[model samples]
Target chain A: MSVELIILIVVITALIFDFTNGFHDAANAMATCVATGAFKPKMAVLLAAIMNLIGAFLSTNVAKTISGGIVDDQLITPQTVFAALVGAILWNLLTWLFGLPSSSSHAIFGALIGAVLVQAGLIGIHFSTVASKILLPALVAPVVAGVASYLGTKIAYKGKHNLPKESKKRYRNAQRVSSLLVALSHGTSDGQKTMGIITLVLVAGTLQLGGDQMPWWGQAPGTGPHWWVILSAGIAIALGTYSGGWRIMRTMGKGMAEIEPPQGFAAETAGMSCILASSHLGFGLSTTHIVSGAIMGTGLARTPEEVRWNTAKRMLIAWGLTLPAAALVGGLAAWVAHFGSWGFLVVLAVLVIGSVTIKIVSSKNHVSHENVNDSHEVTVLAKAAISSVTETIPNPLAPALPEEIADHPLAASPLRLTGLKPRPKPKVPKKKKTPPKSKKKKQRKAAQQKAAVAKAQEHEAAREKAAKAKAAKEKAAATRAAKAAKAKEVNDA
Target chain B: MPSLIYAIDWMALLLVAAVSIAATVIIAALMSVSNYFFHPPKGEEKASQPRRILGFIFLGLMACVVAFGLYLMIPYFH
Candidate 1:
C-alpha cells in the first residue's frame, strides 16, 4: 500500500485504541461512585465523559513522552505502530469482556516494544528510559496511592461518628465531588497516550515523505502531538466514556469489594492525585493500577473481611499476563504486516473476525446499565455453596416430609399460591367533544377569553390593594389603643 | 548491585514516590476531613458557623490542590 494510505490506517487504528482505552478505564473513574450510589451509573459515565474531554486539552506533556520517550522513533515505521495498536486494542477488548481491569498503557507499551524488537532489535528499544520512566513508576505509583488511601480512610473514620443516615449523606456528596476530580485527571492523563501514538505515526510518516523537520507545534523533532491529533483522541475517549463499560464497572465497583461512601471518597481522591502527578511528570503509568490499588487499600482499612482476596488474585494474574500476552500478539501482527499490502489485508480481516467473535460470545451474558450493580458470578457461587452446606444437614423432625425437601419457599408452602392477585384496571376519564365552531365564532370566543382574563387580573389587583389598606388601618388602630391604655394607666397611678 | 542501581534514575523514582504519596494523602485527608466536619451527628443541630467555615477551608484547599495539579500539566512547566 501507499505510504499515505498506511498512515491513514494507522491514525484510524490509533483512534480506535483510544476509544477502547477510555471505555476500559471508565471503571477507574466511576466504579466506586456507582457502587456507593453517589451517582447513577448513567449519570456518572456522562460526567466522566465531559471531564475526560476537558482533561485531554489540559496538557500534552504525557503525549510528548509517549511519542519519543519510550522507543526510538527514527527506526520504527507507522506500520509498526499500527501493529502495536492492534495488539493493545485486542487485549483491551479481551480484558473488558472478562471484567478484568488491566492496564491499557501497559498493553500499548508491551506491544510497541515487541513490534520494535521484531523490526529493529535492541537498538530501537530504550531500556533505560523504559525502566526508569515506565516500569519503576508503575511499580511504585500503586503502592503510594494505596498507602495514602489507607491513611485517608483511617482518618475519615477516626472522629466521633455521626448518625449512619447523616454520615452516609455526607460521604455520598463527598464521593460525587472526588469522583469528578478523578475523571478529570483521567482525561488529562490516559487520553494523552493515544495522542502520543498518533503523533508518533505522523512523525514517522513525515520522515518517510523526506521532511527532515518536525511540525512547528511540536517543541522539537517528535516532541509534541499535533493539535488535531489531540482533539481526535480527546473526542474518541469521551465517546467511549459516555458509552459506559458496565461489565468492568461492576467488577471494580461491586466485585472487588463492598465500597462504602467514605472509602470511595478516599480512594478516588488518592487515585486522582497520583494520576495527575504522573501526567505532569509525563509518566504513562496505568490509572487502573493506581485506582484499583487505592480501592483495595481503603477496603483493607475499613474492614479486612470486605475485601475479596480471591477476586483480587484473579485481577493480579490478569495484570501479570498483560505484557507478555500483548507482546506476543503484537510481534505476530508486525511479522504478518511485514509482507506488504496483502498481509495488511489479512491482518485487518483477522482483527475484524476476532472482534466479532468476542462480541457474539459476550452477548450471551450481557452487562448493561440496568444490571451493572447486580452481584456477579463469583458472589453467586459463594451464595450457592453456603446454601448447599446448609441444605445438607437434614432436619430430624421433617425427615419424611416430601414438601420440606423442596428448595423453594413457595414450593414448601402447603396452600398452593398459583399466581399473584390481579389488580383492577384503572378507569379512564373520557374527554367530552364539542361541536365544531365556524372561524368567526372561534375568533370571537378567543377575544372573549382574553377579555375575561384581563378582567380577572384587574379584580385580583383591586382585592390585594384593599386588603393591604385594611391591614395598615388595623395596625394604626391597635397602636393608638395601646398608647391610650398606657396613658390611662399612668393617670390611675 | 551498585552499578545496576546507578543505571536507574533512582533519584527521580524516589522523588516520584514521595511526591505521589504526599499529594495523595493530603488530598484524601482534606476530602475526608471536609466530610466529617460538614456532617455532624443527627441529634445535633447543623454545623455551627465556625465549623462550617473550617469545612469550606478544607474544601478550598482540596480544590487548590487539584488546580495546582492541572497547572502542572502545562508543557511549559516541564
Candidate 2:
C-alpha cells in the first residue's frame, strides 16, 4: 500500500478500535441500573448515549493523555498508532465475545507500549507515566470499591432501623436522581479519553508537528483534543453505548453480586464521583476499575457474603497482568512496524488470530441476563450464599434463622465459601495425557461425598448440642420466674 | 513558507467542511418534524431548560473543539 493509503487504513482501523472500546466498556456505565431494572435495556443505553455526548463537552483530560503522554508521536505516525489500535481492537472483540471484562484501556495501553518498545526500544516506554496514571488507578480502584461497598451496605441496612417509613421512601427517591447524575458523570469523563487519542493522531499526521513534541499542550491545558475530535469521540462512544456490550453487562451487572437498586445506585454513584474527579484533573482513570470497585463496594455494604471473591481474584489477576502484557504487545508491534509497512501487517495478523483463539478457549461459560440473578454458583462466593442456601432447605422445620442472618452469614456447605476466590489452576508439564484434571474431578467427588456425610454427622451433633443449650436456657428462665413469684408471695404475706 | 500555509488552506477547508457537515446532518435529522404527521406521538418527550442547558453544553463543547483544532491546523508566525 502507498504511504497515504496505509495511513488512511490505519486511521480507519484506530476509529474501529475506538468503536469497539465503546461497546466493550458500555456496561461499566449502565450495567448496574439495567441489571436492577432501573431502566429497560433500550432506555438505559439511550440515556447513557445522550449523556455521554453531553459529557464529551465537559473535559479533555483523558484525551491529552492518549494523544501525548504514552508514546512519542514524532517517532510514530498515525500509521504506527493505527497498528497499535488494531491490536487493541482485536483483543476487545475477542474478550467481549467470551464475556471477559478485560480492560480495553489496558489493551490499548499494551498495544501502544508494545509497539513503542519495539520501535524506540526501552527508551520509548514511559513506565512512570503509565504507573502513576493507569497502573495505580487500575489496582486501587477495585480495592477502594470493595471497601466502599462493604461499608456502604453495612450502613444503609443498619442505619435504616431507626428511620420512619417516609424517610426510607425519601432515600429511595434520592437514589433515582443520584443514579442519573452518575450516568452523566461517566459520559463526560470516559468520552474524553478517546478524544485525546484521536487528536494525537491528527496532530501527528502533519509536518508542522515534530516527533513527540507537544508545544501546544505546553501552551495550554485542554488543548490536546481538538473540537472535531471531541465530536467524533462522543458520537462514536454514544453509538457504541447504544449498541451495548450485553455480554459485559451480564458480567458486570450480575456476576459480581446480587445488585439491588439501592446498591446499584451506590456503586454507580461511587464510580461517577471517582471518574469525574479524575477527568477534571486530566487523569486518564480507568472507568472499568471505578465501576468494578463501586459494585464491589456496594456488595460489601449490603452483604459481604455475596461478593464473589473467586471471580474477583481472576479479575484482579487480569488487572495485574494487563499493563505489562499490553506494553509487551505494543512494543513488539512497534518493533515490527519499525521495519516499515510489512511489519505492521504481520503484527496485525498475529493479533487477530491470537485473540480469536483466546475467544474460543475462554467462552466455555457464557454469562447472560437470564441467569444473572439466579442462586449463587459454587464458583462465586457471594455473602448472599448463606441467605440463598438457608432459604433453600425445602423443609420449613429445619431451623429458625437468626434475625441478623444477612449480617452474621454462614455457609451451608463444608467448603466454607469466603466470597470470590481464583480457582486454583494446574500447570501443564508439556507432557502427553495429563491425568490431573480427572484426579481433581475424582478428588472433588470424594470431597462432595465426604461433605454430605459430614453434613449428616454435623446435623445430628448440632441438634443434640442445640437441644442441650435450649434446655439450659429454658431452665435458667424458669428459675428466674420462680424467684420472682416467691418474692411476690412473701411480700403479699 | 507562506505557500505551505496556503496549500494547507484547501486541506484545512476540506477537513472543516467534513466536520461541519457531520454536525449539521445530525442536527437536521433529529430536529426535523416533517415525518411527525405520519407518526405523531401521544406525547412528545420535551427537553426542559435544564436538558437544553445540557444540550447547549455539548454545542459549546463542539465550538471549543473546533476552535482548538483550527489552532493546531493553522500555520502562523513563521
List candidate 2 segments past 4 Å from native. A58-74, A159-173, A208-228, A281-284, A346-493, B1-78
Tens-digit lDDT track for model 1 on A1-493?
8777888888898898989899998999999998988999899999999999998988566444453456786656877888888889899888888888998888988888888888988888777766665567667766877887887787777742332567677767877877887888778777777777777677667667666565443334546676888899999999999888787898889887787888898888778767766655545457899998899888888777878888788888988888788888888889899899998877778777878887776765667777787664322212222211212333344434475546643333322232433233357999886556787698889999999999999999999999999999999999999999999999999
lDDT of 2 at A399: 54
lDDT of 2: 0.59
Score chain A of each prediction against the true chain A by TM-score and list the results: 0.73, 0.65
Model 2 TM-score, all chains together: 0.58
Give the DockQ (2 decimals) of all models. Answer: 0.33, 0.02
Candidate with the greatest TM-score versus the true structure:
1
How much of the true contact map at the interface does candidate 1 reproduce, as a fraction?
0.55
In angstroms, how far off is A338's CA in candidate 1?
Answer: 0.5
